[model samples]
Target: MDAVVKKIIMEVKKGDQQAFAELVDLYKDKVYQISYRMLGNVHEAQDVSQEAFLRAYTNLDSYDMNRKFSTWLFRIATNLSIDRIRKKKPDFHLDDPVGGTEDLNYYSQIAADEELPEDKVVQYEMQEWIQNEISELPPKYRSAIILKYLEDLSLKEIGEILNLPVATVKTRIHRGREALRKRLRHS
Candidate 1:
């Protein structure tokens, strides 16, 4: 953690609104990114991110000083996104019978970029395809991948965020990545 962030957290613990606001400004993008990746919709991600911050702020007294504030905030965001996912009930069992009907505008933009070489374009497509496959993974694996890769959190941090053992976090990340790799290779 940076000294500034540490200071802000300390101040926040003492009920400083300005310090809390600063902390939120520092972490909002990261929270939003995690939410966006998990929820797959900008609007829901925004709502979840906002709700996470609000919940964190309201429960600031419960925050531990020993941990990184970003980690704490991300945990809240992840839980909120998962709750939203449960509420929506996405079907993980079905394959796309109508090939390529889903939103490919984001994928298409990357593929259309002239700056990328042919090999790079292929890699991008594969990565995008893998991301789509990951969405079909069970919730636990999906959360593991989002935290490990998209949020760049360490296994210990991920374990802390998800309230799981470090070994469990490692297993989930490995299994999730392997599943994604298999799906991409076969596709």
Candidate 2:
């Protein structure tokens, strides 16, 4: 952890409400994105995000200062998302897939690189299709894939976040990739 975050954590530990709120503000987007991607629902994501923060605050004293607080927060968020998935077994609602799939904006850049406009459109569609496929993966695999590829975390970091071994994380990523490839291939 950086000095500023450490100072904030110390203040939070001392019962500084402002410090806690600052912590939430700093990590809210990342927490929301992880939950949204993991649960594939906006409402659930918001609930999970809020719950994760509450849990973090409640257990802040037990948090090891030696660890990265962001990872710990993500661990809480991902666990809540996984629990929601298990308890709800939410049906694959094609009509209400995960929100925020619209961040993909590569059409112009690719168009300038000799890729025709038609091809760019197809690419965008394929990307959205792939995102949907990812959201459909089993929770473990989905978390691994998202943390690794989307969030750009390393295998060790992903393993820490998911409480899985590195080799297992690798296998999950491989399986997730193959599953996505198979889905696209069939489509």
The numbered model that scores best in TM-score is 2
Clashes of each: 0, 0
User: Where does model 1 exceed 4 Å of error?
Assistant: 89-131
Candidate 2 structure, TM-score to reference: 0.79
Please list all clashing residue pairs in model 1, or write none if there are none. none
What is the per-residue lDDT of model 1 for residues 146-178, given as tens digits with 9 covering 90 to 100? Answer: 888888888999998999999999899889888
Kindly list the per-residue Cα lDDT of model 2 for residues 20-54, writing each as its tens digit. Answer: 98899889998998988887667888999999999
* Predicted structure with the largest lDDT when compared to the true one: 2
C-alpha RMSD in Å of predicted model 2 compared with the true structure:
7.5
Model-by-model lDDT, in order?
A: 0.81, 0.85
**lDDT for model 1, on a 0 to 1 scale?**
0.81
Which regions of candidate 2 are displaced past 4 Å? 89-128
